[model samples]
Target: MKKVLFASTALIATAGVAAAEVNFSGYGRFGIGYVEDRSETTIVRGPGADGLNGTADDVLARSTAQTDDVILVSRFRLNIDGIAETDGGVRFEGRVRLQADEDASNGEANSAGLNGARFSVIYGGLRVDAGNVAGSFDNLANYYGNEVGLELFAGQYSGVDYNFLAYSSTGSGANAVFFQYSVGDFSFGASYDQAQATVIGAGGTTSTTVDADRWDISATYTFNNITAAVAYGQTDAGVAGVSDPSLTVLTLGGEWGDFSGTLFVADDATQVASTDGTAWGLSAAYNLGAATTLLFTYGDGNASADTQQVAIGAIYDLGGGASLRGGIGRNDCDSCASDTIVADFGAQFNF
Candidate 1:
C-alpha cells in the first residue's frame, strides 16, 4: 500500500486533467488484550408504587459479571487512492479512508473523519463501484478466509447474523451500487442498496422507520489450486411487522505447500431473531520457513450446540512491513455464562 505518483495534477481536483495518481497506504495495530469474565447489563428501575424517578412503575434489572480484564488495543488506518487513465482504455478510481480506534466511539479517538468515497470504473475485466459500495455479500472472494487471531477473529464467521449490505465508512454508506467481473478463473459480483432503517418492536418498546432494500450476489471459481465461492444476500424490509433477511455464503480455499486452508458456510438468516441457523468455519495457515507463520480457527455459532470457537496463532516477519502477531481462544455461546477466554498480542505495520 504505498505507491505515489502525481503527474500533471492540480492535486486530484484535476485542474486541467491530464494525469493523476495518488496512493498512500494504511495499517497499524497495537495490542495486549484479554478478556475472560465479562458481562454487564444495567437497566434497573424497580420502583412500582409511586417510587421516585420518572417511570410508570418500573421494574427491570438483572445482569452482571466482571472479573478478568487486560486491555490496551489500538488501530489506525488511512488510505487514499486516486488514479486515472483513459484514452480508449478506460480506468478511473478513487478511495478514501482514515480510521482510528482505541474503542472507536465511546473512547472517541479521532471521532470519525474522512471515509465515504469510493469511485471506480475500469474496463476489460469490468469493474464499477459508486459511493460507499462494497457489498456483494461484502465483496466475497474466499469469503474472508475465516480469519484468525491477533484480532483477525472471524472464527465461525462470528455467527453471521444476517441482514446484509455492507460498506459504510460513515457518510454515503449504503448509497451503494457495485459491479465486478472477471473472465478466466471466473468471478462476478453485484450489489445494490436503499436505506433508512430503525426498526424495533415488541418487548423492547417500539420503533419504526422502514424502507430498506439491500441486495447482493457473488460467484467465483478457480480449479487446480481450488477456490470456490458463492454468496447471496437480501434484506427488503417492506414493513408488515418487518422481517425479511437472508444471506448465504460458501467458500473453499487452497494452497498446499506450506499449507493454507479455508472452508466456510454461512446461512445467516433472520426473521427478526433467534439469530437463525448455520454458520461453519475452519481456517488454517502454516508456513514455517524463516518468516514464520501459523494460525488456526474454528467456529460454529448459529442456532444451538452451545455455540463454539477455537483458535491459535503466530506470525513473525520483520522484514519491511513489520509483523509479529499473537493469539489464543476459546469461546462459547448460548448467551454465555461459562466459556470465554480470549487473548491477543500484536504489532503490525504497513505503509
Candidate 2:
C-alpha cells in the first residue's frame, strides 16, 4: 500500500502538537472462485404419522446436495492514520478503516463505513495500542505465511481458530489492550481482551450479564537469516456450558536469495472435535524471474481422517503496485463424500 499525506492546517491547529501527520492507504482485490464440492441444503415437507396432507402433523427434513459452483469475489479497504509528536519525543497515534466486501450467496451485505478505532502510543521500539487492537497471537511473525488464494485462505493449517482477539473491521471489537517491543532482531508482544453483554428478561425487570475474556503472548527472534516465533493464547468463556479454548503455535521462516520458505505447527483445543489435534504446514515460494514467482503449500491437520491439503500457484507482477495471482488446491475433508477441489484467479492492487 502507498500512503498519501494530509497537509491541512486546520488539523494541525486543532491537534495543538509540535508536529502532526495524517495519511491514507489501503488495497483492493477482485476475482472469480470455483469449488468442486460446494453444497447446499433443501427442506422437504411431508405428511407425518397422521398420513394427511396439509394437516397440522407434518415433518420437515433437510437434505444436502453438491452445487459445484462458481462465484465472484472482491473486497476494498481504506485505512486512515494520524500521528502527533510532542516536543519530548513521545508520539500519539490513531487509526481507523473503511472496508467493503462482495455480497455472495448467503453472504451479508457489507457497505463501506468507518468501523472501530485504535489509539496508540509509540516511543523508540515500544508501542501500546488500545481499542480494536490486534492480539498477540495474530501479530506473531510468519503466523499467516501459509495463506494463499484470492481470499487468502489457509487451507488445512489454520494457525489459531479465532481463540484470540482480532481487529474487527465491521464493528467495535472487544475491549482490548496490547503492547509490543522490538530491539535488534528480537520482538515481544502481549494482549488482553474482554467483552460483556447484558440480556434482559421478558418482563424487563431482570437481567443477566455474560462476560468473555482472552489473552495471548508472543515472541520472535531472528538469527542467521532465519526468524523463529512462538505464540500462546487462551480464552475463558463466562457462560455456563461453554468450553474454554487454547492454542500454542510455533513458526520458522527465512528468505534465501530467490527462495523463501516457512514451517509452522500448532496445538489447538478449540472444541471442534474434527480439528482439535496438532496441525502442521509448510509454504514455499521461488522467484522464477523478475516478474513471476511460483508457490506451493501443504498441510496436515492431524485429525482423525481426511486431514491433508496441497496447493500450487503462481504470482505475476503487473508493476505499479499491482499483481495477478491464482491457485488450485485440494482439501481432504472428512465430511465431504469426495475430495474437494478449490481454485481461484484474481488481481490485486495497493495504493
Highest-lDDT candidate: 2
lDDT of 2 by residue, 1-351 (tens): 123223354466447665887778999998887777566767677765555444434536778876536877788999988888888888999989999986544233468888789999999999999999889866888776756687764443543344578888868877699999999999999998876656544434455777767889999999998999999887776667878778888999999999999988998777777667787888988999979988888877656552577888888999999999888887765554677677889999999
Deviation in Å, model 1, residue 110 alpha carbon? 39
Report the Cα RMSD per candidate.
22.1, 6.6
Write candidate 1's Cα lDDT for 22-57 as tens digits. Answer: 777988888777766543444677654555443444
Clashes of each: 0, 0
lDDT of 2: 0.78
Question: What ranges in model 2 sit over 4 Å off?
Answer: 1-15, 37-68, 106-109, 159-162, 196-211, 239-243, 304-308
Sliding window of 10 residues with minimal summed lDDT for model 1: 1-10
Q: Which regions of candidate 1 deviate over 4 angstroms?
A: 1-19, 22-81, 84-132, 135-157, 167-212, 215-234, 237-242, 245-269, 272-302, 305-307, 322-351
Report the alpha-carbon TM-score of model 2 versus the true structure.
0.81
